[model samples]
Target chain A: MIDVLYFAWVRERIGLPRERIETGAATVAELVEELRGREERYQAAFADLTSLRVALDQELASFDAPLAGVREVAFFPPMTGG
Target chain B: MRIAVQAEPFDLGAEVSAFTAGVRGAGAVVSFTGLVRDEGGSLSGMEIEHYPGMTGKAISGIAAEAVARWNLVDALVIHRYGKLAPGEAIMMVATAALHRGDAFAAAEYLMDYLKSRAPFWKKELSAGGEAWVAAKDSDEDALKRW
Candidate 1:
């Protein structure tokens, strides 16, 4: 089981901050595809992968990154921090 | 190096003073504070959301990079999340070095990385409604200089 977290507008669109998911997807992109098939809200939140950023186990990662032993994954829009 | 991620407001003057006093041999100290600007008076406040488990680690990693690259004597980063009012302090970065150039450059480097690399997201609340602030391309461009 891996914890999937969402932030900012992604959280607003998905209506949750985090969730536990059991999946066999090998990559982040595959996991996103699985999520998109689950619900329309997930589809909308992830409609454009270009506008979203992904993190694996609290570190920034690419969609092609493997999910091997990762315990946490976060999806969010580009950061606007300062 | 000192990194603080908290919801409570911090006093910029006190923070700067304390950081300045802590650096023993540094001849120059540079500090930058970011404030919430209510452009056109439309913005009422800001709501900052961040990844709780990653915020501190990300900030410290950036700070560590700045310290190594600039050979800084010391560095401090303090960022606040949650609701913040217009004109209130949102965050600050302070750096101490042997010369002004290193201090200034390191502070700017820290700011640039923090703007695009940090996990914090800001939502501006106005009379019309609330919306997440999109990351500016200029901010990402700024990172290329370093």
Candidate 2:
């Protein structure tokens, strides 16, 4: 099981902050595909992969990054911090 | 180096004084503060959200990089998350070095990295409604320079 977190508008669309998902996906992109197939809200939140950024185990990661022993994944729009 | 990610407002004056006092043999100290801008008359307030586990660590990593690259004597970063009114301080970065050039460059580098690399996301509340501020392409381009 891996903890999945959503932030900002992604959380607003998904209607939650975090969840624990049990998946056998090999990569972040595959996991996103699985999520997009789950529900309409997930589909909507992930409609445009270009606008989103993913972090694996609290470190910024690419979508193609392998999900080997990662325990946490966070999805959000590009950061607007300063 | 000191890094703080807190929901409470910080006293900029006290922070600067404390950071400066701790630095030894530094001839120049530079500090920058980011404030919540009203941006016309539409903005009512701002809400900042950040990843709990990654915020502090990410900032410290960036600060460490700044210290190494600029040979800074000391560095401090303090950022607040939660509701903030217009004109309120949102975050601050200070760097101390043996010369003004390094201090200023390090401070700018820290600001550029903090703008995009940090996990913090900001949403602006306005009369029209609330909206998450989009990350500017220019911010990403700014990081390429460093």
Candidate 3:
């Protein structure tokens, strides 16, 4: 099981900040596809990969990165911090 | 070097003083503070959201890079996440070095990375309602300079 976290508008659209999911996905992109197939909200949140950023185990990562042994995955829009 | 990611507000003066107090070899210090801008008088406040586990780590990595790239004597980064009123400080970065050029360049480098690389989202609270601030394309362009 791995924890998937959504932030900003992604969380608003999904109505969740985080969730534990049991999956067999091999990579972050595959995991996203799995989530997108789950429900309408997930579909909306994961619709545009271009506007989203992903992190694996609290470190910024690419969607094609492997998910093996990773405990957490986070998705959010581009950061606006300063 | 030090990095702080918190919801609590901090004093800019105090922080600057503390950051530069013990420096023995540094001849230059540069400090930059970011504030919540109330443009056109519509903004009432701002809300900042950050990934708790990643905020500190990301900032530390940025600061470490700044120190190494510029040979900074010391560096400090403090960013606050939560509700803040207009004109209130959102974050600050300070860098000390042997000369002004290094200090200034390092400070700008830190700002550029913090704006795009850090995992913090900002929502502007205005009379109409609250809306997430979009990441400007220029911010990404700013990264090319570094």
Evaluated against the true structure, the overall lDDT of model 1 is 0.97
At residue B26, give the lDDT of candidate 1. Answer: 99
lDDT, candidate 2, B1-146, per-residue tens: 99999999999999999999999899999999999999986899999999998998899999999999999999999999999999999999999999999999999999999999999999999998999999999999999999
**Candidate 1 chain A: minimum summed lDDT over ten consecutive residues — where?**
A73-82
Tens digit of per-residue lDDT, candidate 3, span A1-82: 9999989999999998999999999999999899899899989999999999999998999999999999999999999999
Per-residue accuracy of model 3 over B47-118 as CA lDDT, tens digit each? 999999898999999999999999999999999999999999999999999999999999999999999999
Error of 3 at B38 (Å): 0.7
List DockQ, one per candidate, in order. Answer: 0.95, 0.91, 0.92
Reference-based lDDT, residue A70, model 3: 98
Ranking by lDDT: 1, 2, 3
DockQ of model 2, rounded to 2 decimals: 0.91
Q: List the candidate 1 regions with Cα displacement exceeding 4 Å.
A: none
In the range A1-82, model 1's lDDT, one tens digit per residue, is 9999999999999999999999999999999999999999999999999999999999999999999999999999999899
> Which sections of candidate 2 miss by over 4 Å?
none
Clashes of 3: 0
Candidate 1 residue-wise lDDT at B127: 92
Error of 2 at A50 (Å): 0.6
On a 0 to 1 DockQ scale, where is model 3?
0.92
Candidate 1 CAPRI level: high
User: Can you tell me the CAPRI class of model 3?
Assistant: high
RMSD of each: 0.5, 0.6, 0.8
